[model samples]
Target: MAKRFFIKTFGCQMNVNDSEKMAGLLRDMGYEKAQTPEEADIVIVNTCSVRAKPDNKAYSFIGNLKRLKKRRPDLVVAVAGCVPQKEKEQILRFPHVDLVFGTFNFVKLPQLLERVKREGRVVEILNRKIPEEEKLPLVDSYLENPFIAYVTVQRGCNRFCTYCIVPFTRGRERSVAPHLVVEEVKRLAERGVKEVHLLGQNVDFYGYQGTDLADLLYMVSEVEGVERVRFTTSHPAGFSERIARAIRDIPKVCPYVHLPPQSGSNRVLERMNRGYTREEYIEKVQMLREFVPNVALSGDFIVGFPGETEEDFEQTLSLVEECVFDQAFVFEYSPRPFTKAATFKDDVPKEVKNRRLQTLQELVKKQALERNLERVGKVEEVLIEGFSPKGSELYGRTADNKPVAVEGSEELIGKTVEVEITQASPFFLKGKPVTTGVRSKR
Candidate 1:
């Protein structure tokens, strides 16, 4: 009988991709995936430390897992991801945890699990150093959409942003070989995948010497079956003119970008170690707009940071209004253990952070709603993903990556369909399929 293992992922898309790698690794080690915690001999929780709320939730969830282990003494429990890297010793203080692995230590999990079973004791393997050659397993990808997949082209960050722990937890920048990335994209495309999201800590900082992100994008666009390409979390400083030109020229690349600005105030941005000033960021956005006129833009923002005054917060609000993002992921500053910001007094009161967050959320809702409303009556080409969990309707995203719910058949899955926008909301759109075929408007 094969051992059953369960892995729960919590965080950004990068962590979700990590879970897929873990699953593949476990399968190769003779363990089958368990759908639920109760049925598994082993359980892994991939965590996040981006905010206080998520970190607290991870701890509470781990505690709950401990209770489950008490009910079944033979179970192997592991905690992985950003939280483990940040609070290694603190997590070891817990009773039921049998293994604690970190973000950069995934390749050692098979051996660690064996040690836990043989010794009948706790095991930990989290070191904050990128390996000279990190090898990720090629297990079956458990993605929600077969036509869409995320392939991480790079790891870690050199930018030691004050409020961010990624620089410490994930370590310095490491780029995967451009040829390897192209090969992976080619394989995915051959597997009937229509879209691929090239993921990294900061994507625009992709390649150093041989081939840059622009050159890599051009190579990926030439892959046979790949119909669309997208990427995330681009740093403003790295969005060079060469990359902008590549995106404009690549017909397969999606017309969407997620550029995190953190703050609009030059003072706040500098304090956060963002490196790019307000004017530079604005100029980059304007440059993108010049090349890709219909491009949809999204961003990340922090509502309150240490020493953030009313003027600083207002500058953020002003920038938000000026940029008019299609969507924005807003966060309140949380001090991660090893980051520089954590050494400073967390002087911004919780109430003030909460208030600023609320203001930003309201503004974002207004802006998102306005953007969605503008799409009304437009016929957008959407890749049919699958049925929506809420209803019998099929679901997919526009070229701009806006979610659209449509009445579709199972046959439509993996195929592109033209959806006439009938209704639009702040977050998603409701559409009816006009035809079975997808064609470019241009």
Candidate 2:
């Protein structure tokens, strides 16, 4: 019987894309995907180290898998991704973990598995430079709807924000050639993909040898079937007028930007080593709004950093009121291993952090609801993704990335339809289809 493999992925979309790539590699090695970890001959845990919760969750899941390993001693257990990259030899402390690999070690998966089979256990977290000759083969595992895909334009981060571990886990900044990225988009477009979300640790910094993000956006938007182009996790410092202009000029680029400001206090911002001031961030926001007035803006904010005071927290709330963001992700500070912030005293009391987080969340909720309410009775072009979990209604996202649920059939899944907003909720919009024949075009 052919061997079966199961992978549990944690963290962001980048990790999702990585798991898909790993699945493609395993499929090429004659391994079928298992629906459950217990039924598989091999189980892999893709971990995240960005926060303590995900790190603890990874270990908790692995602890449960220990029993499965005992029941099936032949089962090959592997740990990969960010946590392994950071922990390295420490990951081998888990006796049942038969193989461990890192972020850049993905291409060596098959060989590493082979070595494990022969040598009984292995660790392959070496930070070897990826050779220019190595390339990811075109693989198709999206057997279901393939209308949306994630194309990684760059890997790693050089920013080294005091609170972040991505630089250590994912390595230094390296961008894929613009032509290679274009080719990937073209292939996806040929395979019926209508939306391509460019992924990276810091996407706005995308450039290699004079080719910048604006250049790549223009090239990708020009692809024949790609109707929507989106990118994520942009740093405020790298955001420029050129990128803003590209969003305004490129018909296919979505009008949603997820710029993480971290904190609103210039003092806190400087401490975080974010390299941009509160006023500077606001300037970028102003520029984006000037170019695309109706653009939806979302942001991330970290509350209660090491030295954050009540006044600093108020500055964040004040900024939120000033920006009136369409959406926001508010997080309490949690220091991670080796991050510069971890060295400092976690000065904010737990109760204080929780209170501040609650206040910030409540304020963001009001702003988001107000923004959504403004859309009521308006017509929006929604790219139908699929049916809701209960299958009672079809769901999709607008150009600004707002979730909209409409009453429709499964046949409308992959097409873009006009929706008339009838009701608005804090998190999603309820609408009805206005037309059936209209579809998105590049």
Off by over 4 Å in 2: 131-134, 138-140, 143-145
Query: In candidate 1, how many clashes are counted?
Result: 0
Best by lDDT: 2
lDDT of each: 0.83, 0.87
Model 1 C-alpha lDDT per residue in residues 195-231, reported as the tens digit of each score: 8999889888988577888888898888988888898
User: Given candidate 2, what's the lDDT at residue 43?
Assistant: 94
RMSD of 2: 1.7
RMSD of each: 2.0, 1.7
